[model samples]
Target: MPIRMHDTLRRKKVDFSTIEAGKVSMYVCGVTVYDRCHLGHARCYLSFDLIHRWLEQSGFDVHYVQNFTDIDDKIIHRANELDGDWKKLVDENIETYYEDMDALNILRADDYPRCTDYVDDMIRITADLIEKGNAYVADDGVYFSIESAPEKYGMLTGQILENVRSGAGGRVDDTGKSKRDHKDFALWKAAKPGEPTWDSPWGAGRPGWHIECTAMSMDYFGAQFDIHGGGHDLRFPHHEAEIFQGECHTGCSPVVHHWLHNGFVNLDGEKMSKSLGNFWTINEILKKVDAMVLRFALINAHYRSPIDMNDALLNDAERNYNRVLECYVTSLKGCLAENNVPLPVADFASTNPLSKSLALLEKMGEGFAKAMDDDFNSREAVAKVLGAVREIMKMHNSDMDAVDSNAFSHYAIDWLEETAGAVLGVLPTREMALAEPEEDPRKLEIADEVDALLLARTQARSDKDWAKADEIRDALHQMGVVVTDTAEGPTWDLA
Candidate 1:
């Protein structure tokens, strides 16, 4: 089936076709870079990352661009509070942003255009908007004249102009500022004392929050691009302003072919808020949970659905992720043991557990693709992954002796790794996840102790000492080890 995605502008899912054949130019609004990224940021970026991964997997050459709002009110205020240079603060946070994102395994964008680096381009676009009579220079700064392009102005938000209030119901504030209309937002802000300022035709000032994205996106993807995305909160004045300024300058009808917005991250039934002290930064969360587990938790929900962050949700995610990982590891071990042995091709077509398992694996792959193709529904895709892993595990345990050398088993292993590991990025490669590192003496001693306890527990069970076995299991659980008994044997993993 052809790929379809929900376009916020159209308010419906539509067939997705790139502007250029077999190629996609996508621009997602990135971080403000004033502070650490939070769960909301993770949700937005990870959603796009999944989209990027699937597009590439589907044979589309995707040029993904994400921009940084390096210079902003928050950055300036924080810099002043720290008694440090704004650039230094931004630079430090930018590095931390990379560190956090890298930990999450999000693919790096093709281009990361910082706002400060494109002041000249922003000035040119602002000047062009003024010349086109779509914007006007005020005593304070340049503002996009909403009334100038009335026909195109609220198309993205579907708001009727006359009925629209001056402040757009607190979505934007026009108070105490020079503007032809209250709905008109800033294109440039005249620099205040001690604020970072750049030389511009509008006097020494910086680009407004909305103008930076338009300027930077146009610089990379031209006046028109395949898709533009950000958090759902940006669907209002921020994105709407981009549409107004971009079209007014380029004389185009739609600035982008599609507009995608991921839903917000909610905490305790409310929007995650820094002021409420309910928000958790990616770094803060990573310190407590593994990065892969957090990534799975973030992607387990549909990108358009608000994910509620809480201990229970994360715990469930951790357990589900461990199941997937253990299955993959088991398959990996089997493939290594049966190296270079190929199953009879005829057996794969026969009606047996091996062939049935292959069929299920194929069906799972189809489901994964179908879910992803339909608006990049990662939540459904992940379900399909778990289903495939479950079926693969059953076949591994039940039919290993019958089809130990079957090529289908190897094929299944490779398919699982690619779909779950490469496409979803939830599973790391064996080299990365299982490679032995230089061990600390204390950790080695702990491992030895755990191994000895596991052996004793196995013997106790064999001797029918259920009480002793349960006691050892409880002790191991206290030490952060989880034990599961399978038909083959008992297996243990970290909690």
Candidate 2:
């Protein structure tokens, strides 16, 4: 119940104590702009959004930054395949990324530093690394010497220096790449024919994948910050390389105070990827279900736990999402409809509520904070929120008025709205979902009108006035209702 989180460093849970008290700086590895955003991407961003929300809700002033890899090998390759402009491809995909995330209610990062925008800073850092003897120029470009950094190579990734495998297709020429060890990665790559390039310390070239984060994060949040996060897949080469570069430039060992990574998203128990051909783009999935349900499905399991997304699981998550939203709306309706409403208060409880539903809200709120503090266990924190929602529904069904007065119903609703809505960037209103497909109330109203008209038409038919009966039928049809005659008489419905 106390504010604690599992520190991936120590490999166990510990009480969260920030490097600097009362302030938090967090950065997340953002998208590479070559392709459409997918559900797996949503899982990463949404998970971080919840962590950012909980941190801010817990009274920490969080300056969150996420970067975009706007210029990369994939972006260039994709552009060439389509005979498209490289910058245009990056620009279009970046815009699409924002559109997809906005649809899912993801909080835009305080700073979205694109790799292209920070090329100058990256050059500066590369120059610094070269001057400091941490990087060397290869025939193709500049490479970071793994042997020059302060910590042991592969300290963060736990990869053995000798046995590491480099990624395929883009290996620097072995001649000029004076890596003390073979595992040393690139800092900059010399521009190839038909590739996007910028002028850098080692001639006209682009920043390497890992160097981009190092330069951008240090430029924004200082050489060292409170937290750094990305996918579990990135912990090895990407993040480990980031740490090495940051330390080489800043003369600091741990440029990040804490490291966090969310687990993989599996599609039907297999990793979802382009190769698998089972990747569900966010837009593609949005067409099938609401964004909140997709978000709920991602967070239901622990952040570090793998999830195999299936139709039944998604339906279950949708039901849960609807139930939570319904309870929140119903509670607000009751609170607004109550007497002697409690004034908004600022006191926060650090213990779990055991006695009543209102106390449960306080308890769950505390649990949310504690869970987040413990290393940003957003999965556990969200459980507290869902639990509070469940308790509210139970009380609402049993005794609405008594529950309103006896509990901090007003305050709890406000808290949920603020923390869940503003902070966590989840649902701000029940209206997020479009009109229900089942019998709409307006349709029902029209149906009633149609029935009345049909009754009048039946009477007119019974009176032997075919002209009057036809006139009534035409009038009802004009009102967007269709009437059909049956053996029993007439039945009508809204169109």
Candidate 3:
């Protein structure tokens, strides 16, 4: 099936038809360089990373852009607390964010524009809004005129005027600006003493959080783009505000074609928040599980479903990840031992059981595509990959004597490695997956005893004591040595 994703704007499914043919422009909200990225950040970024990979593999040339709000309030606070230069602090955290993301195998976006770098663009937009009479300067800051775009002010958030009006009375400071309503928000924050600021037409000030994305995304992807994605929590004030302000300035009906939001991260059924003290940093969790394992765990759930960050769930994720790795390793071992085997021809003109397996793989790909297209459902897509693993495992256990080695050849191995490597990004080498000098004391001791048992068993086979031979095979299996009969006699390996 061709890719069709869920459009959050219309709240229905839609295909990825680009405004321009054969190319896609995507913008995702990037991290604010204030602290180390945590599990919540991991879940959001990885979800989008998978979406980007799928789009590329499905034949779309994607130009992905993300922004870094380096000059935000959090960065300023942290810098002052540490007695460090503010820009230096942003630079350090940006570097650290890249490091953690690289370890997780997320591809670099086409552009990572920083808010500090786009000050001129912001100033120009602010000037345009002012010229259009949609904004005014206040003693403390410049605020966008909500009354200017009254027709579509609360369209994105689905709130009525009374609710917006009621909510605003609590937050609005009526003493400052000559505002018609409390729903109006900041466009440019006035420069305070010792905060990062640039000289603008109104005064020295910085762009608001919502204005940064609006300016940066339009600067990169034009007035509108194919898709806009971020965490679900951002939908309310962040994204809704972005759309309202963006449309007001550009006089456009909608700022984006499709909006995608991945589900939230949870800890023991509660939202993972800094105040809850249940939140864990991505680097800190990396110390516990391999980065790939953590990625797998996050992908194990549908991107639209809430994920719980805990030890038990992660343990299961690790086991599932090992199973996928084991499939790759087992195939590698067979391919190495049977080097004379002919390569597979990727055609299926004749009807056969192998064709059924191939058909299953094709169906799996379709299922994954559908799920991913529907709001980037990575968990469901990964489950489809696991389903392919099941079929490959079945084929691996089938007898080779009944089939020609030249026919099946490396078909199963190639299929598993190619799809898994490209999609899930798990490809383990033989040395890393299986072969190594036994460092676990228990494995070494067991291997020694198994070798002694094998010697007696070999003698028994020579003496025609079939019962004794079978007994030793079972015994070795109980000790974790997987035994199999070969033309060269019985071969065994530590499980």
The numbered model that scores best in TM-score is: 1
Candidate 2: count the clashes.
6
TM for candidate 3 is: 0.83
Show pairs that collide, candidate 1.
Answer: 343-406, 343-407
Off by over 4 Å in 2: 1-3, 165-181, 336-355, 399-412, 418-424, 430-495
Query: TM-score per candidate, in order?
Result: 0.90, 0.80, 0.83
Kindly report which residue stretches of model 3 are placed more than 4 angstroms away from their true locations once superposed: 165-180, 336-356, 401-409, 428-495
lDDT of 3 by residue, 213-276 (tens): 9889999887888889999888877887788778878888677988888888899888898898
User: lDDT (CA) for every model shown?
Assistant: 0.86, 0.77, 0.78
lDDT, model 2? 0.77
Error of 2 at 295 (Å): 1.2
Error of 2 at 453 (Å): 16
- Segments in model 1 whose C-alpha atoms lie over 4 Å from true places: 167-176, 337-350, 436-495
lDDT of 2 by residue, 1-495 (tens): 434555455566666567678888899999999989998899898878877876776788889999999988788778989876888888898899999999888878899988888888888898898999988887888888887753566666667766677543365343235444566788888877767788865788788899999988988888789878888899887888887889879988678877878888899888898897999999999998888788877877777778889998899988877776776676566554454655333334523232345556677877766666766665676677788787776766663445443345566577677645675555656453233557768777676667777788889999999999999988987887778889998877775
Give the top-scoring candidate (lDDT).
1
Ordered by lDDT, highest first, the candidates read 1, 3, 2
